[model samples]
Target: MTKKIEVLGSGCARCKQTTKVMEMAVKELGIDAVVEKVEDINEIVNRGVMATPAVAINGKIVFSGKIPSLEEAKALLSKS
Candidate 1:
């Protein structure tokens, strides 16, 4: 199954970096994943995230506020 990963933020550098990190993690792990950037503030807030650069996998948040490590992201993706 393809994992659905989303980076939620206001299209800031940190948000972009989060997406890139997730991409690299998936590539390195050879996992089938779909990564997306969500710049919608409403959506981000609705998810109970008070900070940018939050990561969601399969509709459940795995990380927020800070950039996650490759290993952390890969683990989240694996669950999806």
Candidate 2:
């Protein structure tokens, strides 16, 4: 199965970095995932995340407001 991983932000540097970290973490863990970058402001707000550079896995909010650690990301990805 493929996990849906999304990085939500306004196309900022932090958002890009978050996506990069997520990609690297997934690659390191050998997990199958479909990653996407969401730059839509409305869509981001719908997630109830009051911060930039958030992450979502399987349509569920996993990390928000800051960059997440690889271990934390792995945990969220595993749930997918």
The candidate that achieves the highest TM-score relative to the unseen native structure: 1
Per-residue error at 18 for model 1, in Å? 0.5
Q: Write one digit per residue (lDDT tens) for candidate 2, span 1-80.
A: 88889999999988988998899889988988888999999999888879989998889887899887778778777766
Model 2 compared with the native: what TM-score? 0.90
Q: Give the Å shift of residue 57 in candidate 1.
A: 0.2
Ten contiguous residues minimizing lDDT sum, candidate 1 = 71-80
After superposing candidate 2 on the true structure, give the runs of residues whose Cα lies further than 4 Å from its correct spot.
none
* lDDT by residue for model 1 (1-80), tens: 78888899999888888899999999998987889999999989989999779999988888898988888888877766
Candidate 2: give its CA RMSD in angstroms: 1.2
Question: What TM-score goes with each of the models?
Answer: 0.91, 0.90
Model-by-model lDDT, in order?
0.88, 0.88
